[model samples]
Target chain A: MHSSTFNFERPIPAQPWRGVAVLVIVIILFAAAAWEVRCRAVGYGPTLNDTEDLWAQARRRVEPGSVVIVGDSRAWFDSDLDELERGLGSRPVQLAQPGSCAYPVLEDLANDENFHGTIICSIVPRMFFAPGGPLVENARKAVKRYHTQTLAQRASHRLAVPLEEHVAFLKERDLTTEALLKELPIPNRPGALVPPRPPPYFQSVDRERRARMTESCANPGRLQTRVKTGWSRLFTPPPPPRYIPKEAFEQRIAQAIEARFRDTTAAVEKLRRRGGKVVFVRFPVSGELKAFEDQSTPRTGIWDRLIRDSAAPGIYFEDFPELASFTCPEWSHLSAGDSVEFTRRLVPHLRTALGM
Target chain B: MLGFFKYGNFLLENFQWVLARGGITYKPPHLDVFLPIGISFYTFHSLSYTLDIYRGVMGPTRSLRDFALAVSFFPQLVAGPIVRAGDFLPQLEAPPKPQNDRFLWGLVLMTLGLFEKVVLADTMLAGSADSVFGYAGPLIALDSWLGVIAFAGQIFFDFAGYSTCAIGAALCLGFHLKDNFRFPYAAIGFSDFWRRRHISLSTFLRDYLYIPLGGNRSGAARAMINLIIVMFIGGLWHGAAWTFVVWGLLHGSYLVIERLLKAFVRPTTWTESLGVKLLIGLATYAAVCLAWVFFRASDFTVATRLLRGMFGGHAQADAILSTREILQIGIVTLGMFIVQWSLRETSLEAAVARLPRSVVTAAWAFMAGALILTQGNSNAFIYFQF
Candidate 1:
C-alpha cells in the first residue's frame, strides 16, 4: 500500500518579486543619496548662496597687511576705502554688508587662517537693532535633531585630547564644513535705494533742494501727491494714507536690531574658540537723525547699556554726533563727499584701536 | 500602559484649565507619560480587539508576538485603516507567497496614495483652504460652501492616502486589509456615507456602544438617547475638548432625525428619484461641513465665530467668494471626486493591477517624484490626536 504509485511530485517555489521590489527601492534611495552628496560637494544646498560666496572669496583673498574697514551698511556706503588709503599710508579693505553688526565681522576674523591684520568694527546702535536675526535657530534645531557635535563641544574635546588621542578623536566625529565656511564674512547685495539723494551734504543746502526735487518726481509716494488743480479732484479727494506713527516704527526697528545683535553675538561666540576677535560699532548719523535718536530716549538708553555691556575687546565706536557734521548727508548715512571725509578722519583712530 | 501614563501626565499638566472649567476633579504630578508614537490609534485598536474578544465574537490571541506585530505593523502604525485582529490574524498565520503582479500593483497603489496626499491635498491647502479657513469675518454663502467642499476633499484624500499606503504595505507582506473608504462623498444619505467612511472604526463603535446601550430596542426616544451617548463618547475620543463633543452630538442628532423621518414619512416614487437623492446628498454634505468647523477649530469659540461668519454675521456676501478662492476650491473638489469615483469598485491595488505594466510603473515613478517634491511640512498624522 505504501509503495503504491511511487510517483515523485514537485512543489512550486515562492516568487522573489518582493525581494526584487525592495532591491529596486534600495537602488533608488542610493541614487538619491549619491545625487544629494554630489550637489553638496559642489556647494549647492539651501544655506549656500551669493552671500556665502562673497564671504568665502574675501576670506581667501585678504592678506595679513590688509586694513579691513568693517561695519553695517554705514561702513559699506558711508566710508570710502580709497580715501582711507590716501589719508593713511595703507589700503583698507571694506568688509561690510547693509545690515550686518559687529559679531559676524569678529567671527570672520577669528575663523580665517589667512586673515592676520587690523579689523575696525563699526558699532552702529541702529545697526544692532536691524531685523531678521534668528538665523541660527533652525540650525540649532537641526543639530539637536541629528545629534551633530557642536563646534564648542568639538573644540573642547580636541583641546582635552593628547597627541596620541588626536587621530582617534578625528575618526570619531566628522568635521563640519559649515562651521569652517561660516568663519568667512558673507556680503549681501546692495539694498533698495533710499529716495531723495538724502538731504545732500549739510554744507550744500541748495544741492539738497535740487536732489529733493529730483526725488519727488521719481518716488511713487512723492509723485502721488496731487496738485489742487480741478474742483472735481478737490471734491473727490483720495483716502488718507495708512500711517504708522514714527515712534512705533522706530520701536519695531529697534527691537529687530537688538534681536539680530543678540543672535549674531551667540553665533560668533559659538565659533570664537577658533580664535576670532569680536567688535560692535555705531555709524555716524546726521543732525536731523540725531534728533530722532535723542527723541527715542528709552531706546537710546537701552542701546547705550547694550553697547557698554557688550565689551568683547572689540571697538564700540559712536561716530554719530561727532562725525555728523563731516559725513552724513541724510538722517543716518553719509553722502559721497561725506564718506570720503569720514574715511580720512577714521584712519588714524582705527589704526590706534586695532594696534596696527 | 506606559504610553497611557505619559499621555495622562501630559493631559493633567497641559489641560488643567479644561478640567477646571468642567468642574472635574484631577491633579497633576500624579500622572506619568511614556509616549509611544501613535499611541492613541494603537490603544483604540487594542480596546476594540479586547472588547470583541470579551463579546465572544472573536477569540483572544494566544500569541503576544502576533498581537504586538499586528498593532505595531509600520505601514499602518502611524495612521491606519484600523485593521481588525480577526481579519488580520488569519492572513499572518498562513502567509501568501508574494507574486510579481501583486508587488507591482502595490507599488502603483502606494504612488496613487502619494499623489492624493501631495499633489491634490497639499496644493489645495496652500491655495484656498488656508485663506478661507483663516478668514476672520463671516463668510459669504459661496465662500462658506467652497471652504466646506475643500475641507471634505482634503480630509478624504489625506486619510485615504494613509489607508491605501497601509493596505499596499500589508499586501507586500502577504496580507489583505479592508478598504477604509468607498466614494463616501457620492453617498446619498448620512447612514450610507458613515458606512463608507472609516468603516472599521464606525463598525467598532456600533458593535461596542449602540448594541450595548439597547440600541433601537426601547423606542425612538431611547434610540436617540443611545445615539447621542455614543456620539458624545466618539467626540471625546477625538480629543479632550468641548468642541469635539458638540460636533459629535450634532451629528448624532442629525442621524436620529433622519431615522425618525424615515419611519414616519415614507417617500413616494418621485421623492426617491435622482433629484431627491441629490438634495439629500447636498443636505448631508452641508451638515458634515458644519460639524467639521467644530472639529477643525481650536475650541468652541473659534467654531462659533466661523459659523457666524458662514452665516454672514460680519462681511458682505460679495467679499467672501473671491475668484481665486473659487477656482482653487473647484480644482481640489474636482480632483478629489475623480479619484474617489474611480477607486470605488475595485480596491486601489486591484485597479492598479488592471492597468498595463508600463503605465503602472510610469505612474508610480511620477507619483514618487511628486511626493518628494511637494512633501508637507507635517511629519505627524491628523488622526494621531485620537
Candidate 2:
C-alpha cells in the first residue's frame, strides 16, 4: 500500500527471502569448509599475521623498566622471549617487525621519557640504516598505531585473534585476494619498473608478536629456495628514479644515511642518559645472502660507525664461534629449533652486554 | 567549522602565495586542523534542514531528538549518501517495524557493497592505479590509460559502495535513504552523468544553489555563466585544491558545451540511433575519465603529465604496470561498464526481482564468499576525505 504522507515505504520484492537467506548461509558454510581444507592442504596453518594492531597490543604491555626487543625481522624471529625472560630475569616485549627499520621504534622508546628500559636492538646494516621508505615506514606505522589505535580496532583485533588461531585460510598477508592476485605468473613489459613481491607465508607468529620459521620454510626444499630468492630481491637496492639525476639521487641517499647515523647515535645517547641500556646485536646471516649483505652494506661501514658513534655495547655474531656456528636455513633467519638453541647460547652474552 | 577544518591550511598557503606574487611577505601561522570525519556530509545534512525551514518547504520539527537523529544518523554519518534531513526526520517520527525481508535485502546490499570495495577496488585495481599515479617518471600510453581507467573504476566502486552500504544499513533500520548512484558510467551526457552520480549532492546543488541563482530563468548566456558558477562552487565543495576546482570547471564546460550543441544541432534519425547513443555514452565516459585526472591527481603537474601521456606525449616513457595488473584493470573496467550499461535502464531491485531464486542465492553467496576471501583488508572509503 502506498502512503500519501511524507513517510515513504520502499517496496519489498515478492520473493521467499527467508528461504534465500537459508540457502545463502548453507552455501557460505560449505564454501568456507572447502576453502579451509584447501588452505590447509596448501600448507597454511593457523597463525597470527603481524599487523599494526597486534604490534600495538604488544606495545601496550611495555612497563617502565621492561626489557624490549626492537629492530627488524632478525629480532622478531630469532629472539626467544622465554629464554630471554629466564636469563635476564624479565620478559622482553617483542616490538621488532619483519622488513622494518629499528630507528622509528628506538626513537619512540627514547621519546617515551618514562621508559628507561633495556633495548636489545637487532642490527642488520641494510635494514637498520634505512633512512626512509617502506623499511622505516613499517616501524613508523606500528608506532603510529600504538599511539592512535581506536577502540574499534582494539576490539576487532581481540575478536580476530581467536578466529586466526583456528583458521588456516585467515592468512591476511598471503591468503587475501590482493596477495593471491599478486601471486599470478604474469610477465611485465620490458623496461617496466615493477617492485619485487614480498616472500610468502613462511613464518608463524604468536599473540606476543614472536615469529618462528615454519618447519617447511626451515627445511632445504622449494619453500626455502623461494624464501632465499625472495630475500635477494628484497635486499638489493632499487635503481634511482628516472626523474631524478643519478648523482643527485645518490647524494640525497648519502645525506639521508648520514642523518640516520646521527639520529641513531642521538637516540642511543638519549636512552642511555635516561638510565636505559641498549645492546645492538647482529644476528646470523649465511650463504650467498650473507655474501650479498657483506658486499652491499658491509658491517665496517654502518655497524662499526654506529657502535663508535653511540658508544653502546654491540654483539656481533661473527665475533663469537658459538653464535657464528649456527647457520640460517634461508640465509637470513634461524630455524625454529635453532632459534631456541641460538637464544640459549646468546642469553649469557645479552646478560653480559646489559651488565645483568 | 567545516571550512576552517578542511580549508584553513589551504587558504593560508594560497594567501601566502598571493602575497609573494604581490612582492609583500606575509606569514600566517599554520592552523594545525584535524578535519572531523564526515564534517562536509553532516554540514550539508544540517544545512538542508535550515534551508528547508527558511524556504517554508517544511516546518521545523518539534522534537529536538528526532532532528538530531536526522542530522547524525550513524549509517551515513562518516561517509554518506548525504541524506537530507527532510527525508530522514519523518521516518524517525514512528518507531521502526522489523521486517525479515527488508533486513535480509539490506544484508545482501551490504555484502555487495563490501565486495565492490574490498575485492574489486582494493585488491584488483588500487595497486595498479597507485603504481601508475605514484610513479615519478612518465609512463607509456597503455599504462597511463589503464591507470586512469583503474582509478575511474576504483573511485566509482569505493564511493558507490559506501553509499550502497549506507542505504542498505538505513533500510535495515526501516529508514529509506535515496540512491546515491545509478549506473553513472552509462550516462549518455554530462547532465545525465551528474543526475546518475552522487544524486543527492547534485539535487542539493540544483535546489539550493542553482535555482537560488535564478538557474536558467535568465538568457542562455547568463545560464551558461550560472552553470560555471555553480560548478565552481561544486568543485570547491569537493576540496580546497585548485585541482578539484579544475575538475569541477571541466565538467562545467562539458555541460555548457552540451547545452550549446543541443541548441544548434537538432536531433536527427542518425543522432537518435542506438549506435550513436552508445557512441555518445562512450564519449561521455571518456570525457568524465579525463576530468577524473584532476579530481584524483594531487596537483596540476600530475594532471598535466597524465593528460600528456594519455595523448601519446610519452612514447618513449617507461611502462610501469605488469601484464597481470593490465589485465586486472582491463577486465574489471570492462565488467563494470557492461553491468552499468545493462542496468542503466532499470533499477537494481527490478533486475534482482527478475532473477530466479537460485541465481539470487548463488550470487549473494559468491559475493559473501569473495568478501571473506578478501580478509577485510580495505582502505577507508574515498569520500571520507571530502
Highest lDDT among the candidates is held by which one?
2
Encode model 2's per-residue lDDT on B219-317: one tens digit a residue. Answer: 899888888988998999889999999999999999999999999999999998989989999999999999999998988888889889998897457
Candidate 1 residue-wise lDDT, B206-318, digit = tens: 88789889988988889889988988877777766677889888878888888988998798998789778768876887788888888777766657766776776744332
What TM-score against the true fold does each predicted structure earn?
A: 0.59, 0.97
Residue runs of model 2 more than 4 Å from their true location after superposition: A1-7
RMSD in Å for all candidates:
14.5, 1.9
TM-score of 1: 0.59
User: Which portions of model 1 miss their true places by more than 4 Å?
Assistant: A1-356, B1-34, B126-148, B315-326, B339-366, B375-379
lDDT of 2 at B162: 86
Instruction: State the lDDT of candidate 1 residue by residue for A1-356, as single tens digits.
Output: 11112122112123343554565576557645664566445323321111222333343445755656555555665666666677656766555544354445555454555555555566554344434332222222322332343465445433433321222111111112212222234332223111111111111111001111122222333221221111122122122212345677667667766666566555445434444444344556545445555564334464556544554434333543445455343344555566667666666665564444
TM match of model 2 to true structure? 0.97
